[model samples]
Target: MKKLSMLLLASALALSLAACGQGKQTGGVKEPAQAQQGDTGKAPQATSKKTTYPLTLKDSSGKEFTFAKAPERIVSLSPTETEVLFAIGLGDKIVGVSDLDDYPAEAKSKPKMGNLQGNPEAIIAANPDIVFAGLSLNKNSVTKLNELKLNLFQTNPKTIDEAIDRVLLLGVITDKQDQAEQVAGQMKKEKQQVVDALKGLKPEQKKKVYIEFSPGWTVGKGEYLDDMIAIAGGVNVASDLQGWKQISEEKVIQANPDVIFFAKGVPNLEKTIRERSGWDKIAAIQGGKVVGLDDNLMSRPGPRITKALVDMAKALYPELVK
Candidate 1:
C-alpha cells in the first residue's frame, strides 16, 4: 500500500509541474505581442510632434538668408532694414541697429552700429543669428561676414512695391507675418485709393514733371521717382534719359516740363537754379511749377513712400482731391 501511495504522489506532483510550465509559456508568449502593439501605437505620436524649420532663400543681391529657424538675436546693417524690423514688431529681437535707423522711438535705446559701414566687430560681438544689410553694402564686408557662416539678407528696394515686399519678408523672418500683412495691406489700399481718385483726369490736364536734385543732378528715366511721379498723375519729362544722369540746361529746356520737383536741402540748389545760366528758359521755371519734396519721407524705402505718393498726388491734382 505504501509503494502504491508513493507512485500516485509522484504522478500528481509531475502533472502539477507540467501545468505550471504551460502557464509560464502562455504568459511569456502573450506579453511580448501585447507590448509590441503598444510600442507600435506610440511611434506615430512621437513622429507627429516633430518641429519644422523655417524657409531659407537668397535675396535679389545674392545674399544668403535662412528663416527656417527663428533667431533669438538679430542685427540690422541698413537703416531701412532696422526700421523695417521695428515696423514688423521685431523690436525685442533686434540686438543692434545702424545709426541711420531713427524712425521708431523705441529703437533709439538699442545699440547703434554707426552707419551702413558699421563695424563688423561690433556686430559679431552681439552674437546675432541673422544680419540685415542693404544692397549697397560694401561687398568685401558682406563676404567677410558670410565666410564666418553668418546668415545675411540684402535688400535693394527700388520701387514702392519692392519696399512693401521687404516689410513682408522681414515679418516672415521674425514670425510676425500677420502684423506685417496688415500694415502692408493698409498702405496698399491707401495708395490704390489715391490712384483710383485721379484716374478720371485727362492726359492734357496731367502735368509733365521733372525731378531735379541739383543744378545738374536729375533723376534719369525709368527710376522709382519717375514711377512715383507717373502714379501721382504726372508725366516724367526726363523719361528719355538712359538712367540717373547729369542733365544740361539744354536738356531741361527741351523737355519743357510743366512741373519741377526739387528734393529739399540740396546744396546750392535754389541759388544754382536762380543762376542756372539758361535754366529760366524752361517752362517749369517760368510757370512757377517747382515743388520741394521732404528728404526724410520721399527718399527712404519704408511706409513713408505711401505718404509721399499721396501727398504728391494731392499736390499735383488739387482739383481731384477736393
Candidate 2:
C-alpha cells in the first residue's frame, strides 16, 4: 500500500500541470490582446504590436509580478512552461529549466534546476531575470523561492485550452506576444480540427478507454487525460473515480475498455497488463488495442497538448479523424 500510494502521488505530480487563463480580461495587471477564443481551425490574427513593458501580471497562484522590461534571462521550473517559452521564441532567453524539460530538443541542452520543487540556491546561482514555476512545487520550496525574492511567477493549468492561454500569457510576460499568438493560434486550429472531426460522436460510438499512466496508477475525471479522452470521442471507464488514483485491477477487468493507453516510457507497463491474471478477458488486450503515447506529450500540459489531442482522436477513431 505504501508503494501504491507513492505511485498514485507520482502519477498526479508527473502528469497534469497548469498555466494561466484567458488574457484580455478587464484588469489592472493586464496582458496583450488575446486571440479569438472560438476555435474555428484558423490561425490567430497577427498583432503588429509587442507586449508592452512595465508589465504587471498575476501567476496561477494569484501572486502578482511586475516586469520592468522583457526579461533577458529566464529560469523555468515547469517543464510545460519551458516548452511554452520555447514555442513563443523565448528559447534563446531561457537560462535554466526543470529536470523534466526535454521537448523541442533545445530545452534538453539548458541548465537543469531541480524538478517541480525547484532548487532555490541553483535558481539564484543562474541569476535569472525572472522565474516560472509549476504547481507540483513543494510547499517548502515555494516558501524558499519566495523568501529569496527571485522575480518568481507560476502557472497551473487544468485543461488543454487553459494551456493555450498560458502560451499567450507567457508571451505577455516575455514581450513575445506575436510569436505566442502564432504558436497558440496553431494549437487552437489543430485542436479545432480534432473537434470538428469528432463532432456529434454518440456515447456509444466512442471507444471505452482505460489509461494507466504510471505503474498501478490511472487518471479519472477533473484532470487533463480524462478531458482529452472525452474530446477525442472516447469514454473513460475510470471516470467514476476522481483525479489520479491507484488502479483497481478488478474494476478494470470488469469495465473491459476498448482501448488502453499507457505512458510510453514507463518500463514494462504493457507487458504487466498483458500478463496480469484475469485481464485476458478485457476486450482491448484480446484485440491488441493497447497503445503507448509519448510520456511528455501525455504528461506535460503545454502548447503541444493539442498535438496529443489530435493523436488521441486519431487513435480512437482513425476513420473519422483522418
Candidate 3:
C-alpha cells in the first residue's frame, strides 16, 4: 500500500506538474519536416539569425517575461527544464538546480538549491536572472517567489508538440536559437520516424493499449501518454476517462488492453501485473505483452519524450517499427 502511494505521488510530481489540459487525442502529431541532417549529424549551420534584444514572451502560465538581454545566471526547478536548457547549450549559464535535476552528467555538479518546494531565500540568494519552474512548485513557494519579484517562468506542456515548442522558446530567450532549432528538428524527425513506420497500419490493426504509470494509476484520454498511444498506432482503452486517475482491476478486465506498459523501476512488472485478481483473462496477460518502460523517459516532457513515443510504437507494433 505504501509503495503504491509513493508511486502515485511520484507520477503526480513528474506529470501533473508539467502536463496541462486533458487529452486532446490528436491521433498523431504531424510536425513540419525535420532539418536536413548534416554530415556531422548536427543541425546544419543555420543562417545567422539573432534574437533581437528587449525580447518579451509568455510562459505556459500566460505570464509575460521580458529579457533585456540573455540572462547570465539561471535557476531551474524542473528536471525537464534542466535537460532542455542543456540541450540548447546553456549549461554554463545555470547557477542553481533542483535537488532532483540529475541528467546530462553536468547537472549533477550544479549547485543544489531546491526543487518544486525550494526555499525562496536560497533561490533569491543565487541571484539568478531567471528561474524555470512548473506547476509542481508549492503554492506557498510560488507566492513567496512572486512576492520577492523573482522572474519565475512556468512551463506547462501537455503534448509532445508543445514540449518541442518549449525547447524552441527556451532557445530564443537564451540566445541559443540554433541549438534549440536543432533539438526541435531532431524531435520532429523522431516523431516522423514513428509515423512513417506505422503508415501501413489500418484503424482496425491498431492495438488497444493500457499504461500504468504507477500501481493502481493509469493515464486516460486528454493526457500526454494517451496521445502517445494514439501516435504510436494504438488506442488507449482508458480514453474514456480523463487525465491521470486511479483505475480499477474490473475496468482492466473489461477493457482488456492488447498490450500493457508500466514504469520500469518496479520489479517483476509482468508477473506483478499478470497476477492481479481477475486479470488472468486479459489479453495482455495471456499473450505476455506486458512491457516495462523507462520511468524517466515516460515521465519527463522534454527532448526524451520522442524516445518514449518510439518505445511505445515499438512495443505495440514490434514487427513494423523495427
Candidate 4:
C-alpha cells in the first residue's frame, strides 16, 4: 500500500510538470501574438490623434506659440504669407493684409494694415485671431504685439525648402494640411523636374547669367534667387557678393554674363539696360539674351517659385525647356 501511494504521487507530480511546460510554451506563443495584436490595434488610434489642436510650434523667431484652435481670422503682414494663405485655401479666413499684399487679385480687396513697418494699431483694430509678419518687422512692433497678447507668427524663408515648410506650417495652423501638402508636393515635383532636366549639364556647360531686381539691386549667395539661378542651369554673375546688394556697372561689365534677366515692371527695364553706358558691349546685350521675368513670381517666396524656375529655365535654355 505504501509503494502504490508513492507511485500515484510521482505520476501526479509528472503530469503537473508536463502541464506547466505546455502552459508556458502556449503562453509564450500567445503572448507575442496578443502583444502584436494590441500594437496593431493601437497604431490607428495613435496616428489619428496626430495634429489635434491646441497645437504648439516655435516660430521663426524661436518663440513658442500655441493655437487653442485653428485661427479663423488671419492678418497677413507679408505679401508672401498672404499668397501662401490663399494658396492653402485660407483666403476666406484672411481679415486684413499688409500694404504690400497684392497678389491673387482677391488679396487686394482686403483691408491694408501697413507695410514692412506694420501699424500695430491697425493690426489690433482688425481684431485678428493671428498675425503673420515678415522678418523685417521691427523689434518694437513685435514687442507691442506681445504686449497686446496678439498671436504673431513670422514667415521668413531663406530657401525654397524653407518656403515650402512655412506653407505647410501655415496649413497646420489653419487646418488646411491637405491643401498645403498638395501645393507643396506640386512645388517639389515641378522643382525636381527642373533639377532633373539640368542634372546632365556639366559645370563648364552651365551658362553665365545675370539677374537684376532693379538697376543696381542683385541677388548674391544665400538667397533663393541665387539658388533658382543655379537650378535653372545658369550661374549667377553676382553670386560672389552676399545678399541683396547694389552691383557696380563695372563689375557687371566685367562679368559679361551670357544671359541677363531683369525683374518685370522695373520701369523701362529693357530700355534702361540697353541705354546703360558700356552695357551695349556686354555679351548678353550683344546677343539679345536679356529677358524680363515676372517680378512677384521670381521675388516672392511662395508656391510660384517653381513657376519662376520654369520661367527662368525657359529664359536661359530655351531649347531645353518648353
lDDT of each: 0.65, 0.76, 0.77, 0.73
The C-alpha local distance difference test score for the whole of candidate 3 amounts to: 0.77
Residue by residue across 1-322, what tens digits does model 2's lDDT show? 2322222232221111223332322222244475785668776663465655576655666676667878999998877778888888888899998776778899999999976667887899999998887655677888888899887776666566777777777776677777878988998998899889988787668889999877778888977778889888889999998988877899999999999988777778789888999999999999989998877788777877889889888888888897
Order of candidate numbers by lDDT, starting with the best: 3, 2, 4, 1
Position 229, candidate 1: lDDT? 82
Clashing pairs in 3: 22-222, 23-222, 23-223
Scored against the true structure, residue 38 in model 3 reaches a CA lDDT of: 69
| lDDT of model 1, residue 273 | 66
Tens digits of per-residue lDDT, candidate 1, 1-322, equal 2221111111100011122221211110011122233645664221111112445455656444445566789988765666667776788999998775667788788888766656777888888888877655667877887787777666665556666766665665566666777777877986897889998888888888887655566665544566688889888878777545677777777888877877666665666665676778777789776778765555566666778788788878777854
- Model 2, 101: alpha-carbon shift in Å? 2.0
lDDT of 2 at 134: 64
Between candidates 1 and 4, which one is better according to lDDT?
4
> Could you give me the TM-score of model 3 versus the true structure?
0.85
Predicted structure 4: lDDT: 0.73
TM-score of each: 0.77, 0.85, 0.85, 0.82
Off by over 4 Å in 3: 1-46, 267-270
> Model 2: clashing residue pairs?
18-156, 18-157, 19-156, 19-157
Candidate 4 deviant stretches above 4 angstroms: 1-50
Candidate 4 backbone collisions, by pair: none
Over 4 Å off, model 1: 1-52
lDDT of 4 by residue, 1-322 (tens): 2221111111100011122221221110011122233645564221111245666556666666667777889998777778888998998999998776679999999999876557888988999999887655778988988899888877556666666766676766777777877898998888888887777788998899998877677778877778888889999998889877778989999999999998666678678888899999999999999899887776677888788888899888777777
Candidate 2 ranges with C-alpha deviation above 4 Å: 1-47
The better-scoring model by TM-score among 1 and 3 is: 3
